[model samples]
Target: MSDVFEKVMDLAKRRGFIWPTSECYGAVAGFIDYGPLGAMMKRRVENIWRDFYVIQEGCYEIECPTIAQEAVFIASGHVKGFSDKMCQCPHCKEFLRADHVAEAGGIKNPSTMKNEELAAAIASCTCAACEEVLGTVEVFNFNLMFQTTIGPGSQRVGYLRPETAQGMFVDFSRLLRFYRDKLPFGAVQIGKAYRNEISPRQGMIRLREFTQAEAEIFVHPDEKNHHPSFKRYADYTMPLLTYVQQEKCEEAVPMSMQEAVDKGVIANEYLAYYVALTHHLLVTIGIKPGRLRFRQHLPDERAHYATDCWDAEIRSERFGWVETVGLADRTDYDLKAHAQQSGTPMTVFIQYDEPKKVARRRIIPNMSVLGKQYRNKAKAIFEALANATPTAEGADVEADGEKIHIPADLFEVRDEIVDIRGEDIVPHVIEPSYGIDRMCYAVLEQSYDEDTADGEARTVMRFPPNVAPIQVAVFPLMTRDELDTIAHEIARSLHKAGILAEYDDSGAIGRRYRRQDEIGTPFAITVDYDTKDDQTVTIRDRDSMKQVRIAIDKLPSTVCALLDGSLKFTSLES
Candidate 1:
């Protein structure tokens, strides 16, 4: 870990934000426990995401079981493809990611290499930790899912979900019904997803189990370019690093959503819209705009099922550009896969704006002749023949799970004019997947700051008021009963008004202010001698360290305004 990482983690642990999980037993890597403050901050982050995806985007959220049947992954292709290439070092007897090892040895784009290719690239490399020459490193696939049995004796195989997206895909038929068979509808899931990482050493960046907030917007395949809310982000400009630019190692250039879509840089408006929204969300949560970029995933790096993918990456001092969100255009892959595997119709009936008369081929089955000829199997054969759409030569009919070829005489095809009102289509999905833990880590890393105040070095977390763990801190100027009573009362009043306030009387007023500042408390209320003369207290701003005295009666409203950005701290003092 870097010095900045250590400093931020030290402050995080000391101030009750986060700590390693199960430290009492010498905790293992990649797991963390959010302390009280960290929990509060996490809730704020999740709620903000909900407001954006669920409320503003009008996507209905759903909670699903984390443990799904093996069939779910089998259809989603996770069973066969969700794996990381691994190799074991002969000298150190340690396992490592083959691509990561190859990349560390200065091999470019090692992740795109085949297993045999990756093995050859890293064969001459040495173990990073043991410094021993790695010999005969055979690369193999290591699945990242946590496998388990749903019932006794491993009768029903189950695994923890790798992403929240599959749940939405699996529930497509139900969600379609809920939306009344609408073509452009979305479902979101925010819950725990598990990946049994091979080696998780990057603090909160990689985890065996983490939270994912994923939204799957199912739209008609032909309508991806036509989002009803596209106007909201059409003019929003952000730095976009296209896949072509990435191949040449070029920087991201600023481009508006409309231009990106028109120039075919982005696949569609739906994908570009979510990309912009993710950028806005990251900035709102305190990530510096200059340190953030939307990097388009190269074909070799993107999932095979995804047509286009972009990662919202934040530049961290320790870990470079860390990806926090993924916006992908998964073109009907999920629904079609599940539909084929499960034999469930995962399609939406899209109603056309106007009913149109169209030329069509109609098949008429000869049931009476088939019944007499087929005997006992006649009904099944007739039913199959009736449902079959005939070609010029013949038609394929299915009966009792078996396909049978029916002759031209069994079914007759005729051209007819029919009124077609709608069509059934497997909707394409636009997913904006978030790594909640990584996001929290980024927020903390970016918010961590240090400066000199009153000739003393002080560490401060410059978290935004809306997401900060504590909005206000109440303190008594001195350990006097009169001032303590006033401070406690003021804290109670603030709490009643739905403000998170902390009361401190153990240290000097400056120490109290510093303590609150370190935890990102936006405002601090201190009760002093003047409180006895008149009901008033001093409010100190965490960022500016400026003080303003306001009446006790006006404290709640004034502080509420400050927290919400409706009333500025500077304006209050002036």
Candidate 2:
């Protein structure tokens, strides 16, 4: 781990941000427990995501069970394709991801290699644990889904979902109805997803169970080039690393969403809009803009469902650029796959501006001849034939588990003109999936800073005012009755104003300030003797360490404005 990562993680554990799960016993890898402050910050991140996706973009949010029937994933293609290359160490008998091991052993693009190629590449790799030479290790595919039986019997199969997206896709018909059968709509799911990792080495970055906040926007396939709110981020500029740039080994360049769409770097307006929105969300949640970039997925790197995808990667000191969010254009793949597998029609009816007369050949079954020849089976044959498309010579219809060819004499084709009002089409999905745990870790790492305060080294987490776990900390100048009472009152006022405030009277005022700073509290309110004489208190900014005294009555609004970025601390009168 890098020095910054270690420092941030140490601060996180000591200050109640996050720690290993089941630590009293031997803790397992790939799992963690969020501490109090960590939970609050995570929820705040989720709420901010909801504000952007649900409230601002007008997308409906839904929650589904983490465990789903096997068929759901079978339709989504997770059963056959959601896997990673795995190889077991000969001496240690420990399993590890083959591609990761190959990459660690100086192989380039190991993930795209074939199984044979990967085995050959990782032949010289050593075990990460025992350091035993892995000579000619056998590499095979390992499914990542956590499989289990749903009922008492093992006959019924189920698995924990690897993503929240499949649930949204499975509920497409209901969501389509919820949106009044509209062509353009979205549904968001924020919950836990599980992936059985071969070996999770990264602390919080690669967890077996993690939170995902995903939004699946369904739009007409032909309308992908146009989004109703595309203008919201059309001119928003951000760093983008296209596939061509990656091939050429070039750095990411600043480009507007509009320019990316026009240059075909981004697939469409809908995808570009969401990519820009993801950028805004990451920055809003304390991710440094300078350390964030949107990188397009190379052809071989995209998922089976995604036609075009971009990953929002945050540069961490430990992990160079970790992907926290995926913006993908999954063109009608999910809904279509589910519909075909489940025999359900997942389509949206789009009405035409005007009804038009269309000409087509209609198949009419000859019931009289079919009744004489087959009797009871004749009716089934007629129904099947009526729905079947007729060829030049005949029509093929399945009835009674038998394929019967109806010759031109048995079925009649008529050219008819019919008035068509609308058509049903499977809507394409543009998904923005977020790894919440990774985002939280990134926020902690990026916000970490060390500097001198009052001639002493101070470690602080400079979280954004809105994203901070505690918006303000109320501290008493001293452990005095009057000061404590005033501090409690101020904390209560801030709480009633819907602001998170922590009250501290355990130690000296400086110690309390440092405590809050370690946890990324944006502002600290000190109720001193001046507050007793005049109904005013001093508020210190966490970043600038600047103090401003204002009337106690104006405290709530002042803090609210400051937290909301409507008021600047530097502009405040001291």
Candidate 3:
């Protein structure tokens, strides 16, 4: 780990941000427990995400169970495809991800390699634990899903969802009805997703169980190039590292959403719009824009369902560039898979502006001649023949898993002109899947800073005002009866105004300010002697340490405006 990562983690654990789970009984590697402040900050991040996707974009939010039936995943291809290459260490018997080991051993893009290729790459690699050379170690695919039984015994199989996108796909019918059978609509889910990692060494970056906030936007397959809200992000420009540039070892270039689509860099407007939205959302949640870029997925690395994909990568001291959000154009893959597996029609009816007369072919079965040839099976053959399109010679149909051939005399084909008003189509999906845990870690790493304050070295987390866990910290200069009472009253008033305020009067005033600074509280209110005499107190900004005296009556509104970025600290009267 980098020194900065270690320092930030130490602060996180020391202060009640996050810590290992089951610490007293030897904590697990891939599990963590968030402290009070950490939980608050995580919720703030989620709420901000909700505001962007659900409220602003008008996507309906839905919650689904973490564990789903085996069929749910079988249809989604998770049972067969959701896996990682693993190789066991010869000396220590430790199972490690083969791709990670290959990458560490100077192999590039190890994840796209087949098992045999990965085994060859791991042949010369040494075990991270025992330091023994792998020497032709056997690499095998290991399924990552955590399997379980839904009801009793092992009769009904179930597994923890590896991604939240499946639930929205499974509930497509209901969501379609909710949106009144619209062509374009979105459903979002924010919940826990699980993956049984072989070896999770990146602390919070790689977890067995983590939170996910995903939005699955269903749109007409033909309308991908024209999203209704594309104008909102059409002119917005951001750094994009296209696959073509990546292959040539080129850097990301700033490109507008419209230009990316027009140049065929991004597949369509829907995909580019979400990529731009993801950028804005990450920046809003305190991720530094300079440290963020959207990288297009290489063809070999893209998911099986996606035609085009981009990952919002954030630069980190320890993990170079980590993928926090993935935006992909999953074109009707999920719905079609489920529909075929469940024997349900997952389609929407789109009405044409004007009804048109079209030529259609009709097949008529001659049952009277079929009854003599096959007595009991004639009706079945006739029914099957009615649905099959026959060539000039004959028609072939399947009945009870048996392919039956119908001679030209047994069926007749006729062409007819019919008026068609509408057609049913399977909608494509544009998904923005977020790794919430990675995002939280990114927020922490990017917000960490150390500098001199009051001629003393101090550590601080420079969280954005709206994204801070506590918006303001209330303090009394001393631990006196009158000071404590006034501070409590001020805290209560701020709370009533929906501002998260913490009242502190325990230690020295300087120490209290340092505590709030470390926790990323943007403002600190001190109720001192002046407040008792003149009904006014001092408010200190966390970033600049500048103080401004304001009446107690104006504290809530002032703090609200400051937190919302309407009022600037430098503009306040001193």
lDDT of 3 by residue, 374-458 (tens): 7888877877887897888899998767898888988789889998999999999999999999999999999999999879998
- Candidate 3 least-lDDT 10 residues: 147-156
Candidate 3 CA-lDDT value: 0.92
lDDT for 298 (candidate 3):
97
* lDDT (tens digit, per residue) of candidate 1 on 68-154: 999999999998788888888887778888888887888899878889988988888878868776767899989999989997787
Off by over 4 Å in 2: 84-141, 366-369, 376-415
Distance (Å) between predicted and true CA of 48, model 3?
0.2
TM-score of every candidate relative to the true structure: 0.87, 0.88, 0.88
lDDT of 2 by residue, 1-574 (tens): 4599898998899889898899999789999999999999999999999999999999989999999999999999999789878999988899888988987889999988899999988888888878887997889989999999977767899999999999999998889988888879999999999999877978999999999999999999999999998999999999899999999999899999999999998999999999999999998988879999899999999988899999999999888999999999999899989999999999988889998899987777777887898898898898888788878888888999999888888878898999899999989999999999999999999899989988999888999887788899998898785898999999999999999988989877788888888888999999999898999999999988889899999999999999988998999953
- In candidate 1, how many clashes are counted? 0
Worst lDDT 10-window in candidate 2: 361-370
lDDT per prediction?
A: 0.89, 0.91, 0.92
Model 2 scores a C-alpha lDDT of 0.91
The TM-score measured for candidate 3 stands at: 0.88
